[model samples]
Target chain A: DQQVKQNSPSLSVQEGRISILNCDYTNSMFDYFLWYKKYPAEGPTFLISISSIKDKNEDGRFTVFLNKSAKHLSLHIVPSQPGDSAVYFCAALVTDSWGKFQFGAGTQVVVTP
Target chain B: NAGVTQTPKFRILKIGQSMTLQCAQDMNHNYMYWYRQDPGMGLKLIYYSVGAGITDKGEVPNGYNVSRSTTEDFPLRLELAAPSQTSVYFCASSSSEAGNTEAFFGQGTRLTVV
Candidate 1:
């Protein structure tokens, strides 16, 4: 079973606009959520994360919002730049199980110049 | 420093053949994992190691084996290659520490079986 799901396989947005990537999870036991960005032929890099206790976390141009009640979380990139185009994967950490992580299929975002 | 290095970035194997995929991490991480990604699908864990001499299977461990002889190296072995095994494999490492659970992945190895 896929505990984490990214329904949208692809997304497109204009440069200098907002780009939002959504993720949903079925396992309520997951408390830590993370977002990773990957480029073509490269490994994924950590972007940002939030805990179950917090509703939102922000870093510069990127922000992650978590809604525990809805079992959903999203990554928001404001004033999106061309360089932001890549595949984004949402992951949840299962700390109790020796820190095992569950990841979504991923969403490919294209920022138009 | 090379955080996580996976050798043979790309490979093609014939059905019934066998080979091993090498993975090493310079970060001295206690937790190492092997994952495979199929087309249009998320990564599935094949195997994982907590430290030297301790290993366990993950979501999709069939047709694959792993050995963790040292903390710095973890290798995956395919006993009998199959066409369904063709996919991109990724090696990742992370710390079990409270604040450093973020995983670092290697570039990945694309394996094709024909």
Candidate 2:
């Protein structure tokens, strides 16, 4: 079973606009959510993260919003730039699973100029 | 500082062949993990190690083996290669400070089993 899911495989947004990527999870035991950005031929880099206790967390242009009631989380990038185009993956930490992280299928975001 | 390093960036193996993929971390992390990513699929855990001499299987551990002899090294072995095993493998490490923490990943190894 897929504990974490990102239904949208791809997304497109114009530069200077906002880019929103959504993710959902079925396991309630997950208390921490993280987002990673991956570029071609390179490893994924951590972007932002949010704990279950917080509804939102912001860092510069990146923001993560978590909703326990909906079992969902989203990454928002305001004034998106063309360099922001890449594959975004959302992962959840299974609090009881020895630090094993469950990652979503990933969403390919395209920021056009 | 080369947080995480994986050797053999690309390899091609024939069916029934066996080979080992090397991974090492200079961060002295106690937790290390091996994951494989298939086309259009999310990363799937293959194996992991909490510390030296302690290893555990992950979601997809069949046909694969791993050893954690030292905190800095974790190697994955493929007993007998299969076409289904063709995928990109990634090695990651993280500190044991908390349950929820970011992991540092290597560039990745692309393996093709023909």
Which of the numbered candidates is closest to the native, going by highest lDDT? 1
Q: What tens digits encode model 2's per-residue C-alpha lDDT throughout A1-113?
A: 99999999999999999999999999999999999999987878889999999999999999999999999999999989999999999999965567798999999999988
TM-score of 2: 0.98
Model 1 chain A: lowest-lDDT 10 consecutive positions: A93-102
Using alpha carbons, what is the TM-score of model 1? 0.98
**Please, what are the lDDT tens digits per residue for candidate 1 over residues A43-79?**
8889999989899999999999999999999999998
lDDT of 2 by residue, B51-106 (tens): 99999999999999999999999999998999999999999998888643888899
What value does the lDDT take at residue B32 in candidate 1? 97
The regions of model 2 sitting more than 4 angstroms off are none
Clashing pairs in 2: none
Return the top candidate by TM-score. Answer: 1
How many clashing residue pairs appear in each of the predictions shown?
0, 0
Using DockQ as the measure, which candidate wins? 1
